[model samples]
Target chain A: MREVILKTTQLSKRYGNFTALDNADMTVYRGDIYGLIGRNGAGKTTVMKIVTGLTEQSSGEYEIFGKTGKAAENEKRKIGCLIENPAFFGNLTAYQNLRYYCYQKGITDLKQIEEALKLVQLSDVGNKKFRKFSLGMKQRLGIAFAVMDNPDLIILDEPINGLDPIGISELRDTFRRLNAERGITIVISSHILSELYAVATRFLIIDNGKVLKEVTKQELDLECSRCIVLKTNDTKRAATLIENKLNISDYKVIDSGEIRIYDESAKPDEIGRTLIQNDVTVSGIFESGVSLEDYFKQLVGEAQS
Target chain B: MINIIRSDFYRIFRGIAVYIAIGIMLLAIGVSIYMIQPGYIGNASVGDINNENFKTSNYDEVMSEYTLDELRAMSLSDYRQVMLKVTGYELDRDILGTNINLYYVFIFAAALAVTVDFSGSSIKNTLTSAISRRKYFLSKLIFVNLMCLIFLFANTYIMYFANIIFNTKQFSSDISEITKITVMQIPPVLALAAVLTGIAFITRKTAVFNTVAIPLIMVFQLILNIVAAALSVQEEYLHYELQLMLAKLANNPTESYMINAYLICGGIIVLFYTAGWLSFRKAEIK
Candidate 1:
């Protein structure tokens, strides 16, 4: 079994009458670039906060490096987090802010600060005050802070929020490098599914404070693979024809007029001919792959239903 | 814990607010020294002069009996004596009164120090580190007390040097007595700092803490005085108020009032610190 860097078992969080997170279970393994996918107010941040000790779970427990209760504090020191907005002293420069935290963390080697800034490509602007930094720079600085201590686990919530395309790509490369070279387990959440899809090895889909599904890169790739989309007047008949006639069981009837065939070997021409032969009026037939966004939507749709 | 304290001190010194507070304090001291001229002293002594029945007619006769040179020498000696009584270290009991308003500055400093972590959301970073909540709370408590003590000593020395420069008279109290008086004033200030810091941490907003804490301190002092009056405690023994206790301690350092002052202020510090720490430990950072 891979070393589990962090695990939450039936975790729940409630604020007053509102249940922010409900019976959520999550697992992040060492060296895994885990992507957390959710819509706004989907309890993504709540989970990250609980893991980082910014907030407490209402029920259940989470273990860091297989430690629970007070012992987890020591485990937390190995985790770096940037939940929500990156918080720092606006009056201090990026270097100063990082230095202050370094002091707090008792990191005497100042070289780490320089290296972190350099990694974020912020070495040139290290002396610029945080208040004067652009939104993109601030986000980069936040990432730098998270990765500065060379933490075993880095938990980032929407770390790419304000980055430009180039900045995002740079950060993506940085994330990949950290996970590949340094063996850092990264848990990142972002609405930009394309970017997340590029780096995440595993995906956790959550909706309404509950974990909808957990998918590995292989599973997600299979789900997002090129598939024949069949639109017929009778999707039930089309689905049956694709399954019985084409011997393709990996198919779903999305609606009365739509059927999605996930069989990579099933040809669109054959699928359309089979639907026609089955006396179903074929409207549209084409091959397409699911985007991460579409996959997330489907997961949430399933959870809601 | 040491790292937290060191970081807090670094942040405090780097920020502009602490310097602003210190500047305001020094300015207040400078203005007070400049305002305490001979004319004001003479006016202040008028009531005492009348109470003593030292008629103005006697001054005219004395002036006539002495030559101009003799009169000048005599007037200089009298001026020195009055200045000694008014501005000497022994006269420093009123130092607290002249600088009591500076308590607001100290309150601002304490509030800023405690609330910076929340205002900037830096506490999240600190909490996520290896430090525990208990250590953070203890570090803040130590930081506040250390700052209060430093300010107390700074104010005491400023008043001492100001007196020496302006009055040009020998101090009635020795350095040891003056040091004791200054040291006795610290407990109440530390108690006040504790309460303000507690309010800052509990509210986690400097504006709210200031708005609530300043009026709270004033009203608390008022209520204590009202209760003391209702109980018909002798005015001399009514060191229940912090200012009163500080003044009484400064004037009579060896008195029982000093012990009572320390006990009451020390108790307040403990209560506020405990509440602050508990609230901080449980506070959920967003």
Candidate 2:
């Protein structure tokens, strides 16, 4: 079984009468890029802030690495977060700023700073002051800080907000590299669906301080289609049987041997049985849900409605 | 806590503000000592005090007996006493070195070290992964007290040696006496630093912290003096306030006065530190 890196059950945060987070539940596993997808003020950043111990929860509880309370707080040292915008001393250079963080984090070896700078492609401009950096550069610096300590889990809120296309692509590669090579669990939040879609293995859709849905990448891919997509050895035979036996004519043969049956009433088990009885090899059969954007919008809109 | 202090040191040394503040402090010291040098009155240094009209009838008769050379040859402290008798100017060299102005330095140091972090959002990074709120607040208090004490003692000694070098032996206090005065002043100055630390934690914004800190002592003094005068309070009771006590304690305070100062200063330190920690412990790092 995959290691549960972080889990929150009914975690909440309230400011006065308005709740910033309302009984939110989230779970992350080791090596998983958990994307928190929500619009602005939807408690996406609030969860990240709370988990990192930058702020306290009003109620509920959370654990890091199976530890709770003070133990869980101690576990926070293994997690790095960049909440909201990149917070740094503007007057100090990138190297100097990281040095300040290094001291705070109690990092003794100075080489980690260099390694982080190189990982974010900021090694060359380490001497450049933070105030003079471009927005993209600032975002890169934030990512560098998150990964600097070689944390077991890194939480980034809107990590791709200010990046250019090339920068975003490079950052995706960095995220994948960190997870793939070092077994780091990444929890990143963003309002932009496509950006999270590019790197996240699992996603949690939140709206109005509530979690709408949670789905994995494969499940999300399935949810992107609106029909039962069936792959078989014999497409002609399968199509004939689907049309004649099921009387499903609103279907299209998408590929060489794959067919998309758009009928909502179409059952895959019956179709697979019929196709197998008719000498057609049923390789795969599943209901295709919808496009990623439409699926995300549907979830959020459904939650609100 | 050590790590936080180290990081603060790194940040402070890199910034130009600390250096500028120190320079201003030294300049203020020089000008202050220069103002109390006895030879200088306002902008011009009066070569002969005998030439000035003695407004007081009693000291005027006394001054009429001494020649200009004899008056000029008098020891600096004795001359100052004669000047005090004749001109009614209170000129005690030790008391003139520093007053409540040192509190401004303490406030600035506390603001730069503590308030700037919150205002710049840098405290989020520190508190998130590094240390607990308790340690953060404790480190700030310790560092501010240490830093302000350095400035305070620097003023005391620099004034001591500076007075001797410039104004000659007559105006100077004994080194041991100067040390006694400096030792007695620590509690009150530390209490002042503690108050600033508390303010920094509460305000949590550089602009707001400075706005409160800069005029705080003066405003506090004004309010107290106004209340005291309105009530027709006795002069000795005015010294009960730490701000006034700091100024008066340099003039060879009695044992009772020392005991009173220690009590008041200790209370201030406790009150402000408790308030500061209470504000910081549950404070959200926004």
Candidate 3:
């Protein structure tokens, strides 16, 4: 529904014999919180770097805001990014560091410097050198630098890598505010699928430098079909009864006592009655939906298979 | 380009390694001055021990026959020759007071600046900006040479003041000749800096790169100087051939036949730089 701000077609990056990214086709739409999810060394950073022009691709092409080559410079102005671990001059103050970055980006507004610091919640760092800032604070500063220009699109790579729970929660809230209020499209890469699930509107799952699939938030929501989690004295008996009576065999006993049934069409009451008749004493029964972590694991398993 | 240059300048100015090396150079120069200034005696002998009179004629004969350690036990004349050879030709107060030593400081700057950029992820970020590779390389070359020029002028000015303080009478030695010498020195110094920058970019690191480059550069200059000398070129021109040609052409350094040397050497530098950029542009920054 939203306009596409960035796109890549068969973009590939090769390091000698090894292909770090292979035919990665990705589209980042405007006003969409696009999550790039993958494991370590999954070519997430490579894709980010290539798209940002920090690196070159061996084959294929990428268009930024309908621009290519030197014209990409103009399109780059609309996108802000923090790819990989952000490095700063250790001796410079946080403010000084941001000022240097802004100067490089050709932004002249000193007022935005303050706003950047405030946006990252690093205002209280106050004259502290970059070396002294905590890892979380440094990560925040990187985010601040990325969004300082109020870019239309923001790309962050593991922006919450070093943050604590509270810091991460705060950053999550900040991202929400930025998306909801400013309508800035964000493309963030992270290995933390659960954290991504809370904020991402769309997802691109990558492994071995290839995009396996791209799914929307509504599709992802539909993925979490309602199911029953049963804790019974005998999981074997529960499984047998469900299979024979309800024609269900696709279920897994999480531990020794509980079993999760994946069929959405089966009624919970019918399953309860069948289990009782089969003499499988279910001590507890609760209906819940699948989580992002579960869906991610399934996707990963499917890809591997 | 300005931003990158400013960042490079800040890094160089703030580097402890740079200042430490500067301090060491100044200390060495001070020691040299203390050792040889007029009547100063470094050891049992007067500063006259290292004069050219003892070094060239007699020292060569003695050194060719006797091993180095054997000279330590020889007669005073032999010992004087040995010491003189080790100490090198007398410090020409005319040239010495010119702060010619500070020219090496630019060499140090060029090496450090280029080496540091190649050390980590810095170069990737620097070149990735919306600037031509040529402009990026040129800006660095310009800033480094300018810094070297400033240091050269400042150090020479101070050394001249020192000569005045020491009451050396060489300041008035053919003002035209002194100016020729001073102006002639700039080309070689600038050339050395440019060559080193190119070498650093090619090698891309200090430890192994310098190990290989330093010897190659020294050997190249020595061989080139010998060739130039054999061809009856002036000593100044020979040195210029080795050091200043690239920088001279880049900055339009001189108006003489030296400009020809500059153009030739500068062309080589451009060629090397183009190669370096192409290599770098294709380099995988993992």
In terms of lDDT, the best-performing candidate is 2
Question: lDDT of each model, Cα atoms only?
Answer: 0.77, 0.79, 0.67
**Chain A in model 2: its TM-score?**
0.81
Return the TM-score for candidate 2, rounded to 2 decimals.
0.82
Model 1 CAPRI quality: medium
What fnat does each of the candidate structures reach?
0.73, 0.70, 0.15
> Over 4 Å off in model 2, which ranges?
A229-289, B37-97
User: lDDT value for candidate 1?
Assistant: 0.77
Task: Give the candidate number with the greatest DockQ.
Answer: 1
Q: Clash pairs of candidate 2?
A: A223-A290, A224-A290, A225-A288, A225-A289, A225-A290
Where does candidate 3 chain A have its weakest 10-residue lDDT segment?
A: A98-107
Model 3 scores a TM of: 0.72
Question: Candidate 3: where are CA atoms >4 Å away?
Answer: A126-128, A227-289, B15-18, B21-25, B28-104, B118-120, B123-135, B167-182, B205-264
**Candidate 1 residue lDDT tens string, B139-201:** 877887788777777877776677667644333235576677777677888887888877777
Candidate numbers sorted by TM-score from highest down? 1, 2, 3
Q: Candidate 1, residue B254: CA error in Å?
A: 5.3
Candidate number achieving the greatest TM-score relative to the actual structure: 1
Report the poorest 10 consecutive residues by lDDT, candidate 2 chain A: A218-227
Deviation in Å, model 3, residue A281 alpha carbon: 33
